[model samples]
Target: SMAQDAINRVLVDRAREGKFVVRLKGGDPFLYGRGYEEAHACAEAGIPCTVVPGVSSALSVPALAGIPVSNRGMTHEVTIVSGHLPPGHPGSLVDWEALARMRGTLVVLMGVKNSPAIADSLMAGGRSPETPAAIIVDGSLDGQVTHRCTVGTMATTLTDRGVRPPAIVVVGEVAGLPQVLTRA
Candidate 1:
């Protein structure tokens, strides 16, 4: 977390110097990137910090791969979760069981390394093993790769494909949406 600490310090220092500082980040900063911490630091120093909204990979990545996180009459809810913490970790706040019961799209970020445990937790928590799943690597950029599989085989499929971080994992019916309909 040293890098983040350094970032916060820089933001505070620049704001204190009465300079406008823009901390550009990939996706929505607040999603899981600790944008709030930086904002809080600025506030504590009585500095003005304006937030500019940006696209999040949770939605954009899937769309780029011709997968919609939600579709009319197909799915109305979408849940985005951080896979940074493995299931059952003491510090983890995500309710895997509840997420498992949700009948909607589940988009997981930074979960590539822990996909097996995540998939296991979902299935154990009542999610169907056959649920359609997809992994979009290096999404929204050139050299992006999309791999489709069932929840039961998601981890193995990712491994077989040599999938890595900076990927989005979409689960549910939406992941299996017809390609023809999604083509722009």
Candidate 2:
């Protein structure tokens, strides 16, 4: 968190110096990047801060892997969540059971480490084991690798493929649509 502290300090300093400072970050700064903390700090210091929107990996990653989050009548809703915490962890705010029951695309960010537990929770919560799932590593980059499987086998597939962090996990019918889409 020191990095974020440093960033906030710099923003405050630059604003006090009457200089316009733009904070550039990967994906959308507001999503899991603590962009609001910096904005709040700037405002408290009487600095005017402006936010320029950017594409979030939740949308871009699946798209890069040729998986649309919402496809016509297939799905109209998408729920994006952070997978940083295990399902039962006291610090976790995500309700795995609720998510499992949701009939929509599920996009999980930073959840690779706890994927096994997450999958188990989803299945135990009544999500079909055969539900389509995908893990997109290095998404939207030249080194991107997309692994397709069912929710029942997602963890094993990721382990077998040596999939690591900084990846996106997509689940639901939309996840399987890539097979039907014509690839260019």
Candidate 3:
């Protein structure tokens, strides 16, 4: 259903015919939403277009759970990454070593299935095993569950606890900062 070429063809045809069309997509239209590709197609076809932003899963989920990703003196940067690649993409496309070397907070979406591998790679690439990592399941929903642990133990912790998909994972120094988490 995520065939970009098919969607692009439709948008291009409509734009060429001077017809107005709303390309509705779930989640933030910009963030991993393929909005850029569609926009490019429309523009190249001489079509005028505008973008209306939608709530991204990254911020919305944390907010609903009362976790403010950014807190003064705690964290100022957050990185959001896609856990799954486009169909047919190589399994090891992520540069785990570079990501590990980064200093800001990290947020990974659609990454439940690959969480174990990701954790292993990050640690192998030099990220601290003690680095705090959290897996948030059904984030923002009534059944939301947040499993917090260090990066070293995350893979085992998640497996032992049986946490599953439709989830997001966060890792960084900020994740360890106690002040930002909701006091339960």
Candidate 4:
């Protein structure tokens, strides 16, 4: 809930003072991390800032749980969206209906609180209620848990499993792929 502009000011101020600053952010900054925005702010303030790409949990979390986003004939697409704002929210631009119609994996970031709404919208948009679903909580950290269920039971599974923020939700056939498609 921190303001980007507020942090931008500090970055600019420190750069002006010739203080070398390194902003370490988990995951790829451009992948809904607002890292580009920070770089833009630095550029606008005439500060020389560089953004180093990092691994994104949207892709890594599922992989950590042995879910390949795309495999030969498994799926040809992988869609990642932020569930920070539930579907239908004025601030949300995600088209849950269109996503529901797509064939591939759907990964949601920061969607713990809106899992219910998200599942409901996808089902209402024509996605099968029995569609496979999984939530990788506390991804890449100690005690990480991968909760499995169907899209229909996502809401309940999340609650029953005690899923929380900083989790990645995977919906589609890929969610059920808990084993490496191949080891070669």
Over 1-184, each residue of candidate 2 has an lDDT whose tens digit, in order, gives 3788898999999879888798888889899978899999999998888988789999988887889999999988999999999999999999999999998999999999999999999999999999999999998677888899999999899889999888999999999874653334
Candidate 2: lDDT over CA atoms? Answer: 0.91
Clashes of each: 0, 0, 0, 0
**Best prediction by lDDT:** 2
Q: Which stretches in model 3 have alpha-carbon errors above 4 Å? A: 14-19, 85-93, 177-184
| Comparing 2 and 3 on TM-score, the stronger one | 2
Q: Residue 92, candidate 4: how far off, in angstroms?
A: 1.0
Q: Per-residue lDDT of 1-184 in model 1, one digit per residue for the tens?
A: 3688788889989877878888988888889878899899888878878888778889888988989899999898999999999999998899999999999999999999888999999999999999999999998777888899989999789888988888899999998877643432
Candidate 4 lDDT over 1-106, as tens digits, reads 5688888887889989999988888989899888988899899988887789998999888887888878789899999998999999999999999999998999
TM-score for candidate 2 = 0.94
User: Residue 109 lDDT in model 2?
Assistant: 97
Question: Model 4, clash count?
Answer: 0
- Listing every candidate in turn, what is its Cα RMSD in Å to the true structure after a full C-alpha superposition? 1.8, 1.7, 3.6, 2.5
